[model samples]
Target: MQPSHRYTRLTAIALGIAGVISFGSAGATGFQIRENSVKNQGRAFAGSATGQDDASVVSNNPAAMVNLDTTTIRTDVTLIDLTAKFKGGGRSGAGTPLTGGNGGDPGDATPVPAMSIVVPLHGAFEKLTLGAQLSAPFGLKTEYDSTWVGRYNAIESEVKTIDLTLSAAVKITDRFSVGAGFVYERAEATLTNAVDFGSGICANPQTRPLCLTPNPTAAAFGPQKNDGLAKVKGDDTGIGWILGFQWKPTDALSIGYSHRSEIDHDLAGNITFTKPGNVAAVFAAGGVTTYNNGPGGAALTTPSTDTVSVTYAFNDQFRMMFDAQQTDWHSLQSVDIKRANGNLITSEKFEWDDTMMYALGAEYDFSDSFTLRGGVAKDESPTNDTHRTPRLPDNDRMLYSVGLTWNANEHLSVDAAYTRITIDSPDVDVVSSSSSTLVGKFKGHADLFGIAAQYKF
Candidate 1:
């Protein structure tokens, strides 16, 4: 059986929503979040897999939990301030100059929080440890002026997630330990953009004849004129697994390795459009489907990651650490959206490349109660110039960090950390099917401040 015209129209409208649903930004790279632990962030996460300094290890390397002798709890929060601005010009589908100011600073400050608890077993299970953690492993947010020259490309884009992890670790011997974890993550996204109803109608072969005639509707709407609004919202939950091992070959050195599996989600939601009065009249007069609202969904995959870290203690008062990590961003070759009946609506191309991040750090015991920390890192971006867009103008970046740890008492400690990320300016040239060619350069940076407290019982 053939689909109805209304069904077909809904499919077409949903395609536009899917097109912009692929938007994202990154605090780490490609929308991954890395501010789960203030103590780790202080060292640019260099020794995360082997640091084992607090309960945060439950999420970084569960195997390291074998080193915790008592029950411990840790909580942390980080305030991230991001700045991304665009300087450029654009043209409409009709090859006419698009007019509007460069969108104002589209970046905003956001807070990320996390918590973890670890408990050591007693008696026959003395070598066993169990843990739980709550964190945001991936997220992003960006908003542009509604009337900006690139409005047709994107206006607002946001993605948020919450992850809960249950983990276990067992000491096989004095020198080796292994661990594993199960994760349940929930994700949601909301994106918006302007739609050129005039150009879209005139560009459609089925409707072009109507547009060419002496119709008041055609006269009132043309190219960049009579714009409508499109919005898409979706949410889903997924599961993944984590495996890791920590090895101590000598009293002064610790080495760790960890791997996280990928997660897949089929986000379900609705797409809605708001048309102007003139456009509504035109659609009504021509007996065209209004393309108002309908069900839609998209399939997304959170990439996997692998990391290796080493921490060396030269003396009781100081130590140095190093980490190398890689993300399998190739899993994101494309994003495909579908209708409620399972028919494909559209697919957006990404072709992202896998990337790696490296960091080095050191800690110095300044006194019996105070420790100082410093670090640096190089974070690679997954997207290149050809695939970059206004919704996500991410680029390679350098990170510099410093922090302090205070042991207030035998059972309590506090950590404070700060970091600056400098991003390289990259040019963007996005050509739209609607004839809107957005050409420009982007400047971006971020500052992060974090604090955490840990207690042992």
Candidate 2:
């Protein structure tokens, strides 16, 4: 092989390895997780920013902490089951048929847990309340068969985040309250994909001539004849802030608003390459053994959000709640990966748009010990077909939820809820810079079960 040919192939390998690290699918529309509060989930989060019955307000809306009256602790866990099936075909950069079966279901089942505590002070600090919360705000996981037709696009993709918040609220007046919080968030990701060594060598003009050599061994390294694998893992930490206000003009109605600042992360990690015997021999002949492992980094930003909610009681036995939320996802325009020395490796474009979510909920008091809850929500997707990726197959969806709060005793209450999400089939036709393409249609849905226990002292 010529020197220029080796350089071209090495560059292609670098791009494939770096581009695979993606914060992937399954959650609220666009890689955002919304199962932090089971009580809120029971009502499809309709009045999450205003309802103050549980310690979850520490994270949902700090201003609601003023209504906790006493010390409270809440713990919740939600199980999420997702089904993602793809039907499609793809081709190598050299325009050769990529041979393999459609990838099997890449869906996953995961558990999300959350906990919070709130304490109201008395005496000199009578109007002040303090709280703390731990939750997973954004997460994703999707794995596909290594031998799938789209293996060159993705194999395994996962991202997880943990957030700890410290909040405080003060009652400004008998009918008004204000609050703020500081959030410490950490994010981690791991991704893998098949590396088409054959396409990398045969697609480059400088190397194509060698691929046509008379020797059969020289011709064997062409489209799908030889393949390798690449994997990358990384983690980062960031800080953000939250602010909120609550007002009650009448004894039966309350309104609330909350905002969370965006967090920025610079993920530092390493990429590893695994090559088959034939592929390694070719690279070794070119004196490129060091390309097997190296350090890299990527920049990511968690979007900011604003929410407005209202809670109203019509009579002693019936109540209604509504909410509207907006997320600034447009800040994330692309994913650019860089070497440890600050050299650009590759770029993945997202071009996501800001999105809006709305929900409506109702509650009926079946008895003093039981309250039934149900809600419906409409959530929008930020991705467009032109920029969609197999790592994150998503679209607009509808959510339905039903649950109940059981007052086990004066100081303890248990909440259980079930939620279902139906997503519109999203189509994908992505062509990487290397000229490889992944064309397909995805069918997806999710089921969630949540339970929470809150205690007051």
Candidate 3:
């Protein structure tokens, strides 16, 4: 009785709030978006660590800063056309009339931005370089109809993050350079879901009285109108670091390696509960509650990462690139929430696996002023079917892209790129920890377009 009844409405409410503050899955892979640099977006991020064509590499390999010609500044934006939808069977406990319509397309067109700069030091420090950047490395957004079928499981969810970086690098020799950086990051999120006050019946089984919100004498069963609202908001700031090396074994061959440290944050916020007037009357009469005080807190750690890349020029006019990266997503094992007084609210498990991404790309020099880029990649998601939730039903994906760089003059250049993404169908069925049962499959794909301008002085 303890285990089965333990999953009552309380379980669902807790799970929903947990997913909000710790949104681990983004439109990309496992809540991690790689659209940080526009120049790299065009290359499908193939030479992320090894390619030093521009100041953009600062985000992936601080050491690559030495590859810049002089003082350089770059700014870019990526417009994402992404979405996820559920279509299939969804129901309440057998007897309920599976109220609410299937959640329609719950994705939106969002824009991501990034900026970076690199400067070379001469004279006393002739071979040294300095760089800085501001960008968003992780994020997510999903909004369903307030009364969608999965409302009890999840309704609206949004997460946003930004990072500020500072670093320096030294050129040990013409062929070898190493660099490192420090980062300050911040994250915030909002999650909303429906609460089933009717589950109050499970609070104290011995009494066997149906508990809605305000009073039990009103009826033996809970009313659809009795469903209440639950919303949670949390935000935090933390710090991390990145180290990298760029090596040129031969004039035409370059290899780069980089590692990023993990960031830990403790988000402090409050959960707000709203129940129908009648349901409140019932819960008060029974001395029961779906939740204690609204104030809450959660502890979380963003994953660390490693990337290796190589760029080999076949000839003066053509070059090939390859990149492989691994993220320690396994670090996210569970999420625990505590009230203002330190009492436990709930602890939920994520059982995620580490993930990897592989990419291959090529660059062609059409002339001294024009270049073309194309690439493809396979990216894996950390979440599986069983754990996939309404907030984000993520899965493995394939990316195909094309881009071009036009040097209008010695001081100005423009970069443009387009990508088509295919996401493997994932089951969005989360049964064990939600306030309500939600099951279905999401057939999804996305299109990303990016553009950037660079100036050299």
Candidate 4:
């Protein structure tokens, strides 16, 4: 027999009852990834607003490109390893028997890559220069076992984003320069979590608080739970801008400042949720045989960033660089997803505060062909204890890094760097969809290794 109209409507409502949230911690605040450029990673990104070594400066301070006279192309890749382990006394606030072990280590390895090109102009353009950069500016992938104690809170989250920048700089005088750029970015996300069938119908906005009473259909799946998967993926192109200024007060000191604007996106996609066969049968009998929904809706605004840096060359062999950056994470207060019907799917309250990051780096030139680099940095987390979730157990971090550069030839150079990051333990106390709560502590550490090659044309 064909599915009834009531059953079809129910299914569609179920599908539209949820939306999406995909985020992970990378640096500064939220899941903003900053490891795309290796040469910058070597110095913990310390003089990034000014420069490190190659055309990649276009990603940070385009004005710095005026100092580079060569037509160059550079590419870099980083292998990042993250280890996050949760350990603590876990209890269910729902006052029910727990399911499985505290989520095991939820961290994994991922690779980030980037490329940029810079060309100096002469004659008509004289002191003006042009450059472009392509890189992953935000990303995250964290997964947990399906049966983990906090599975209902989160099972997995994967997010990917890319930023492309077209930039130009003009040297107004021998001592000063200014630059600006237009940026285009795209982002996609996928997330999953278990369903608490035991608690009643999921608390979707369209339904009454007690929509799923102790009915025959609701009783079919009792006590235990139903496995649910939520997949919401979409792509949107957003526009932003970047501005930078560079100053050379004297020959030995250089100062640079840069600002990157925020981009907002109203992502359009499809949201699908699947349940076990037994639960499906119950839903089918209750006029929810199949799920249906129009385009799903998710929205987010990547934060704006500002950086100031100073580089001092005490002598020809040694140099020091220090940098400070501020991220306006407050712009991202919460993530509330809705379906086409304007019903809520899910909501995340971050109420995040602004963040500040500082870095100090030093470089020593052993010879014209060889150099050594080292740096230390501190990064603050935007999430507070009360709002921290298992999916993003982020905390303040300390970083140490070392690297070296070899000028293989006048036209070629290679750079390699390694960094160790440590974070203070953070407590994870998140409530699940079924109204149960999972509480614990999470500890984490990360390692970053990168290599880059630069060719001067």
Cα RMSD to native, each candidate?
Answer: 3.3, 2.5, 3.2, 4.9
Writing each residue's lDDT as its tens digit, candidate 3 over 1-457 gives 1212553436333645577533543336887878867667777879989756677677789989988969999998888877667775565542254478777877778788889899999999989999898888887677788878777777788777898988798999999999999999998878887765554443445433453436645655452445677787888999999999999999999999999999998877877877677656655775664454466777878889999999999999899899999999898877786776776767777888999999999999999899999999999988877677777767899999899999999999999999888889888766533345677787888889999998999
Clashes of each: 1, 0, 15, 4
Question: How much does candidate 3 score in TM-score?
Answer: 0.92
C-alpha lDDT score of every prediction, in listed order: 0.81, 0.82, 0.77, 0.74
Whichever of 3 and 4 has more TM-score, that candidate is 3
Candidate 4 per-residue lDDT, tens place, 129-244, comes to 99999988877778888788876667777777889999999999988999999999987766666665433343332222323565745544333355555445566889999999
Ranking by TM-score: 2, 1, 3, 4
Candidate 3: minimum summed lDDT over ten consecutive residues — where?
Answer: 1-10
Ranking by lDDT: 2, 1, 3, 4
In candidate 4, clashing pairs total 4
**160-191: candidate 1 lDDT, tens digit per residue:** 88999999999999999999999999988787
Candidate of highest lDDT: 2
Q: List model 2 lDDT by residue over 1-457, tens digit each.
A: 4333433434322443333323444558888887888878888889999876878888788999998899999999999888888888888777887778877888778889999999999999999999999999987688889988887777888778899999999999989999999999998877777777777767656566647867856586787777777777888999999999999999899999999999999887777888888778767776654456878777888899999999999998998999999989998788776778887766667788999999999899999899999999999998899887787678999999998999999999999999999999999898754357889899989999999999998
Each model's TM-score, in the order given?
0.93, 0.94, 0.92, 0.89
Q: Clashing residue pairs in candidate 4, if any?
A: 7-287, 11-291, 11-292, 12-292
Q: lDDT of candidate 2?
A: 0.82
